[model samples]
Target: MADELKRRAVHASGAGLVALYLLAAQFDLGLTWDRFQLLMGLLAVGTIALEFLRLYVGLELSLYDSLTREYEQNQFAGYGYYMLSMTVAVLFFEPRVALPAMLMLAIGDPISGTVSDDSLKFVKGPRVLVTMFVVSALIAAPFLHETPLAVVAAAIGATVADGVKLRIGDYIVDDNLTIPIYAGLLATLVLEFGPV
Candidate 1:
């Protein structure tokens, strides 16, 4: 069950990614579209093939599905997805060492939730998010150099993306595309265009 569950999520994520690929083509017209096929191949062959083999080994694939269902019910599945995505990204492609950037989001989420809910009223909502963002920046400063500015930019971008994604997905959209596109664009801008 677990293996099957993992395969389902992986397939869904792959399909979502393929949609993103098509959308991305709109941004860059006249590009030689060769690599897109490669991506599709990886999704259809690599990710699914490895998982299918798990069933032959007598491993319980249903458990993955069960856990994913549980996580969806509990509303904390984002953490698992994050971990899985990062691990796969690192192991498979080695692109976007954006852990520091994403950790800002992960850490800021709980902080924002706490203050926004008044559970930690001693600290203001915006302030707490900012402070967490700042601390994450400080921790990443040595490596990123322009840490403070980068963190602030990412926080603002993430906030806007989150809000916009919800509204956009609410009408004629799949919600799954939000975070990957969010992270992808943010990574591109920060790593490729940002002054830092």
Candidate 2:
């Protein structure tokens, strides 16, 4: 059941991204060749570095160094989420991408975490996904050209991504992956392509 939700969540997120890209293409909204190059390069570098840390060196840097450790230890959630979220938000010109990504952190992480217990309540399986949808939509509103519609899309995207996290990302995500992705995708999009 959990795995199914994870698969569905990924499908949702992927579908949303495809929809957004199609919408953008229809509108002729796109980053220039330069931006795409930069983003891809950055993504490649980031991926390689993360693999090194994860496979070669191992988990040396603790999630504890991350502000997340405090919240994880005390089981108090949403503590540093906003600050970190905001920092990442500035990267992408597309509210669509930003919102879903943000929701992954804000809603998905805390809501699904074992914080105090080994299991979660509202385990209808959709709980975390639903929460991601709601929170991502709220955060994405003001950032998009079509604020209202984009918000809805972001929410949907977030929910889907959260559901897929376990199956797709498989917990390979962390600060290292986060940084390079942010720098690569968002930065390139904004710098190379005008704000979407």
Q: Highest TM-score among the candidates is held by which one?
A: 1
In candidate 1, how many Å is residue 103 off?
1.9
Error of 1 at 193 (Å): 2.6
List TM-score per model, in order: 0.40, 0.38
Q: Stretches of candidate 2 above 4 Å error?
A: 1-54, 57-96, 103-108, 112-124, 164-196
lDDT of each: 0.42, 0.41
Worst 10 residues of 2 by lDDT: 171-180
Clashes of each: 10, 2
Model 2 per-residue lDDT at 100: 44
lDDT of 2 by residue, 34-83 (tens): 44335434544554464455445654454323323332443322223333
What is the per-residue lDDT of model 1 for residues 1-196, given as tens digits with 9 covering 90 to 100? 4454454444334334433544676677532234544544454454344344443443445544533444243233443444444333323321223443344344433333343443523233555546544554453454345444554554454444333334344342221223333443454466567775
Residue 4 error, candidate 2, Å: 24
Report the lDDT of model 1 for residue 59. Answer: 41
